[model samples]
Target: MDDPLAWLDDTAQARQAAGLRRVLAPRDVVEPLVDLASNDYLGLARDARVIEGAVVATRTWGAGSTGSRLVTGTTRLHAELEEALAAFVGTAGALVFSSGYTANLGAVTALSGRGAVVVSDVAAHASLVDAARLSRARVVVARCSAPDEVDRHLAAAPETRRLVVTDGVDSVDGGLAPLAALHAVCRARGAVLLVDDAHGLGVRGPGGAGLVAEAGLAGEPDVVTTATLSKSLGSQGGVVLGSAAVIAHLVDAARAFIFDTGLAPGSVGAALTALGVLRDEPERVAALHRAAAAVAASARSAAPELGVADPTAAMVPVVLGEPDLAVAARDACAAAGLRAGCFRPPSVPEGTSRLRLTARADLSADDLALVDRVLGEVLPAVLGRTGVSAG
Candidate 1:
């Protein structure tokens, strides 16, 4: 062993030199700061009903599912959640997984194989990218997020099964995908379409039904959708929705689902209760949009030249060209009693490092003002350091 561990040090140093190293900051269970960093979009994480659902389920089911769903995992509660999700999203069937990542891995790999060609959107979430790579199909990256690129790729592919993969909402820049047009192209090309609606679920569409339902594409025979419960439903699980045939195919072939432990019993109960809450109080969805709109307006007013865009799905990104500057901006926000998401390389492009500001329905007027005040003071400094402005 001639300095075997030295390579790791070298790699770490290189990452540090490029300002791409990451560090974690733990927080209290109850921090006084306003949160614009977490994925709890509808502010349901701490809801009394959601919490009660989790507690009751946990006490009944003993915390975790005993095994994979095929074994000892499936329960009466799981069936209920799946049925509720399918009905909400207008799908004929649904499957629950341990996480969104595994849902993608299972969906993509099970849907497309050696004889199929998978055309993927370049801006898709990393999970979708990984799933595409693992699909064992000839993976082709679309030229852009536009439907034309996907259509062109499918049109040029061989006379084999075709699958088109994209995201409903871009995770970084918060841009929306043209789901309707993309679906049209898929239909014309006789290709199955897969939309990872992780960012769009529980935020977009009527009463938070999701982007697929919003575009009137839900329940389409050739369409499949995946989403996580962690973001909006304020729980931990992933779900796949589509026709019964597709669900059966995944249940039989998706290794990720077959091999991994089932989702926690608590999460399933919380998600089920949260879904009911959303159905009863759909106004939470509207409140979420109002919060996002308020945050976007503040970002614009803070640094017009910084060029922050409107939130497409409850996310506002203020791009800073340098990793170090983005870190500095994050630190400034933290010091100002505001917690925002800081994204660097790998999460975003090299020059597009940014503060990812997420909106929650619970964000009050005072919280919004704090965000506005903090960004007003912080972004200008970021712009100045990057030579976009003078401090």
Candidate 2:
């Protein structure tokens, strides 16, 4: 008989031919390179206090949550985290989920149904896109940077209930969404606005509350926010912040939350400690922006035509517009003792593959100087092959 999975080989060959074959290249425990690829913006992933918190939680609550949250997983730490997050973000309540993806799923699906319409940002993360698909609602796409177009979509929808969803920060290109303007449009159209501020938490807004709060939209009746603890907080899990009614509804209606196991106890503890650290050291947020700007400036210096945007968060994307050129540039950086993110198709639009460099608040001046020197060498060589002139 023919192999049942023989089609997989054909698909793999197709991917290989297109320069889209991916390899799982795990790093060594002690990589002696300047890191610009990780999402640990605050450098708290391995902080002494954060580690101690994890240890204490593990000792107190064991390794796993043991059950779904509704059954037996709602530990005191979870409750405390929920309350603290709501308070921090200026929301009436908060609900925690196992991951940011799940949080987005829960928030979108619970808030939208057959009669409701969902307007999603074109450049949003996959989580939001999948959430809109799973919502079983009519989905429309609009440019998140263009609030007027979103408003037009909402105005045209016949559904009485409408939802507008977008990222607080564009994950791939690191562009800040127009949160305030989007909220205004949603308000005018009698629609609800959901902002997934996964990249904004612990990196933007007052005391690192997030971009929703920074835009002065926090606690607004029609606005909801979702965020993750894995990035700037240097932990794991996700949370949804909104009115008390929304939180209660999600608890009852969100399948992702009701069916999935709760977030691990250690992650909850580590996140709590990280929150405390962020509260005490808000200046870390400023340091993070400085590092990102420095990286962007360096990348731009090498290929001025790359048009690297000034980042408001901890990410700087160097768009090379070709998958092989981007991969080559990333490898060249690795050879120069630097680790940069290689983003390609699906993560970004076709022909816009690039390097996504993240910044850490603790990156030293010497570290930045190294980035400047390395990008100055790596980007020009790669851009040359792409025929992108080095202005």
Go through the candidates in order and give each one's C-alpha lDDT. 0.89, 0.92
Model 1 lDDT on a 0 to 1 scale? 0.89
How would you encode candidate 1's per-residue C-alpha lDDT over 1-391 as one tens digit per residue?
5987889999999999988887767888989789999999999999999999999999999789999999999989999999999999899999999999999999999999898999888877899899989888999998446788788888899957998888888877778888899999999999999998988888889889999999999999999999999989999999999999999999999999999999989999999999999889889889998999899888889888777777778899988778888888888899888898989988887788889999998888899999889888888877776567732
Where's the lowest-lDDT run of ten residues in candidate 1? 382-391
Tens-digit lDDT string for candidate 2 (34-69): 999999999999899998998999999999999999
- lDDT over C-alpha atoms for residue 257 of model 2: 99
TM-score of each prediction: 0.98, 0.98
TM-score for predicted model 2 compared with the true structure: 0.98
